[model samples]
Target: MGVKIGLTGGIGSGKSTVAGFWQEAGAALIDTDAIARQLSGPDGAAMAAIAAEFGSTMLTPDGALNRSAMRELAFSDATAKQRLEAILHPMIGARARCQAEAAQAAGMQWIVFDVPLLVESGHWRERVDRVLVLDCSEQTQMARVSARPGWTSSSAASVLAAQASRAQRRACADAVIYNDGLDLAALREHVLTLCAQWRRCK
Candidate 1:
């Protein structure tokens, strides 16, 4: 496909901000979270497998997967998270590949995969031409999450704990975008620069 960049970061680390900048730079973006949500929707292929494995309780009254329930289950049980990933990750990856192929065929300059769990999954490393990490200190992350309308520190901590450590993510990243104290403008500039560099490289 085109020059595919894997954009990732820990929870509340501005991964979405980086992705938005990539979009502004004219890169085709495929967010795995969005694809996962679609695959968990009513009539989606993953719904049947999930129902078969976890029963109807995992589904809502509208026949869609209960996202809140799944979130809680995943956080409380490691096996449950693995089981859900096993059913949805492949489908998400397939859709991402299809999008990347289409973008390449259309002569797009780059494709950005906004995958928050890229390091955790490990399977995506080889699929990407480069790995871009949007990084901030854990303290900054906690502050950002705590300041959100409905977020609590404990919940934020749980989400952070589920992902790869900050040190580990930084160690594996091909490029880093430090967003600790920067505003949106600065973040955009960093992403734009990286996008330019990546485009030139390929």
Candidate 2:
């Protein structure tokens, strides 16, 4: 394959924005979060299983996974979180692998797997050439998430608690982008510079 990169970072870490920059630079991006959203949609492949596992109350009137209710349940109940992960992670991984294969077959020199849980997954490390983490302080995480619609400081903390710590993510990263105070232009410039280097080296 080409330069397969496992892109990950905590919630509110501007990971999505950075992923967009990479995509704009010609990298084929497979985002697990987007896949998860599709799988949890009303007509999603995983909806029936989710409803069966968590009962119908965990679903919305439209038969989709009730994300807010499910999130609350997952945080308050560890077993629920594990069960959800069990149902979703394998499906996400399989889909990602297929997409990566297709991208490589299309002659894409860069394939970026944007996984929010790359470090926690434990299986992605060997599959990728590098792990790129979008780094930011926990405080910044809280602030950024709270700024989003329907999110509060408490919910942000819960999300941060669920993911790997900053140090742990950094420990596993081959590269890190500190996005705490960087503006969009600077961030884009930084990303393009890295893309240039990687392309030349590739």
Task: Highest lDDT: give the candidate number.
Answer: 2
Candidate 1 lDDT (Cα, 0 to 1): 0.87
Candidate 1 residue-wise lDDT, 1-202, digit = tens: 4778899999889988788888989988999998988889888879999999889999999778987677688778889988988999999989988988888989987889999999999888889888998889999999998888767888788888888998888888999988998988888888888777776777
How much lDDT does each candidate structure score? Answer: 0.87, 0.90
Q: In model 1, which runs have C-alpha deviations exceeding 4 angstroms?
A: 146-150
Clashing pairs in 2: none
- Evaluate residue 97 in candidate 2 and report its C-alpha lDDT on the 0 to 100 scale: 87
Query: What does candidate 2 score on TM?
Result: 0.97
